[model samples]
Target: MIRVAVVGAGLVASHYAAGLQRLKRAEIEPYGVPLAKFKVIKDYVEEEVVSAYDVDANKVGKPLSEVVKRQLEGVVPVPPDVPDFEVREGVLASSGAGLDKMFPVRGRDQKLPLKEAVEEIAKEFKSDNVNVVLNLISTEPAEPFGDEGKLAKALERGEVSAGQAYAFAAYLAAKDSGKPVAFINLIPTPLANDPAFVKLYEDANSLVLGDDGATGATPLTADLLEHLAERNRKVRYIVQFNIGGNTDFLALTIPERNLMKEKTKSSVVEDILGYDAPHYIKPTGYVEAIGDRKFVAMDIEWITFNGLVDELIVNMRINDSPALAGLAVDLVRLAAALLEKGVKGTFYDVNAFFMKNPGPKEARNKARIKAYYDMISALRELGVIVE
Candidate 1:
């Protein structure tokens, strides 16, 4: 029985929880282990919904059933049985770094300080036996100063109110626990990218991979356009307009953090075209506050030898969290697979599919992602990977 723990319990986390349910009927090997050993074990097919935790007051301490119940009360409803786990209290930290101003400010009474909140989360994971932490917390503008290491050290040395310290502390606990922690940052944070933080996760035998969720709009547009423009045609201009009302777009609207979003949106097209892609690609604005729904627009112009011009425009809409749900399901399964095989450190193949912006962005092969996923799916079919 492999114990799987969900850390966020947010919109996307629920998707992960739901995906786990969908994956329940499918038999997949845990991580790196071959499927041959488990092929004959019919009883190892159980997919247990162990735990779900979040910092929201409405969710903290609630039974998983009740949490699912309340989440349905929102405009966007979730299936009653989607999350079949216990929803516990997660670390609730005070919104520092001026991020709270972006949304309806959290009431002072609802927020918890950094140390207290992190300790609460550590205690929950330790008590619950959670194997993976999928950080689906609300996005914040990129930290203006890339000083997470210095700040983490400072917090460890003394007391720090900022959540950065608590986050680092959580990483530290996961690393030293021998539990093979895997940090999947759906938001753009410096935890994995920072040299100091990377060293910490590495030394602790935990895998830290993130930077972006790569959901659908930005990366999909970049990929399709890049392929189109690379067909021996003279390319001229490209404009990608993405609009959404999720926490992700709201967070990026903060001027200070636009750079991270820009870098992510740019890299997708740039990687494919094999040249600098001059384009406008980013989250334009928020609309309706409709949970996790998003709308994307893509426009391109290419010229012909006869001085003729061709223009292309595309519109794409998707449920952001559910799209990511499948990916997250595969990710947790991969993490559990690695743990079962006693494999540690970075798992590049798993990262490639799950993260939009990975640590080694330059080493990715998009063509091979589907083949790798096929192998994973095949292993599951053979009853080799179980969570």
Candidate 2:
């Protein structure tokens, strides 16, 4: 079985728990899950959320089932069979300032030293036999630790971001247990992109996939840019923005946190188009009344034949958290299967399609359509995708 652990108990985590249970019960079709149709080495039914962690005081001690009901109350039906494991206290480190603005914060590090808290969490992972750990926390301001020595120094000074702390915990879990674990970072911390963490995971025979989950306007904009690129269209400028009511969007109201997201979102232009286009792309605001469904607006102007200018304006309303939750479902299964195939470190084939910034610090974002086919081909060659 592919045992899983979630690092955040937010809306995305709630949707993942509820939707996964429903999918396992066959109460719902796997509509949003991208890889549901293909037969992978690991099946969806074999995946179980065995543990969860969060730094929010209100969520730390509550059962995941109750948390799901509270977050998704009228939005989605919470399966009665959702796991009842308590959401354990997670690490906070330097990332808690913005989170404190949203909710009362409490973390294991507050009660103990950062290293000890990481060790405590790692013990839980070992005890729970977790094969995949999902970092679904809020966007935190973090810089890549290019060297393992620098990462170790930062951990010593408790200067690492929460995502980095948890990733280290997962690494420790794998090292101590002699069983590989996969840490899929869905938030905007730089674990997968950081060479230090990638090398650390490799040493433990574990895997790290992420930087940021691309589940909305970012991917769509990428494909559109590719469409223009393939046609040799010269792009003048691009403007895209999202406004949402989710806690994540609220968290993005903090300039540093919002900047973290912008860095990931804006990378698509230069990476996919092969030239840095003038673009303004990022989450702009949080309107509580709008709830989790986010408003996305995009305006692109490109030079057409004979230097004629063409413009495309598109607007969409997307369910933010649930979109990432769908991708999480595929990621959890893929992570476990990849580990079984002895794939350690960050896998670019998987990240290019699912993550906004991909990984390894140098990996360029690809158009989702091209990324999808390329990833499928890579997986099939690895025997991870049998169908």
Q: Using TM-score, give the best candidate's number.
A: 2
lDDT of 1 by residue, 337-384 (tens): 665555445555555555665554334424223524654664465444
Candidate 2 whole-model C-alpha lDDT, 0 to 1: 0.93
Candidate 1 residue 370 C-alpha distance from true site, Å: 7.6
Candidate 1 lDDT = 0.56
Alpha-carbon RMSD, candidate 2: 0.7
Model 1 TM-score relative to the real fold = 0.74
lDDT of 1 at 105: 33
lDDT for each of the candidates?
Answer: 0.56, 0.93
Clashes of each: 9, 0
Pairs with steric clashes in candidate 1: 27-380, 28-380, 28-385, 29-384, 29-385, 30-337, 30-385, 31-337, 31-338
Q: Which runs in model 1 stand beyond 4 Å of their true positions?
A: 22-49, 73-120, 143-151, 157-170, 229-234, 250-253, 256-259, 289-291, 303-308, 361-387
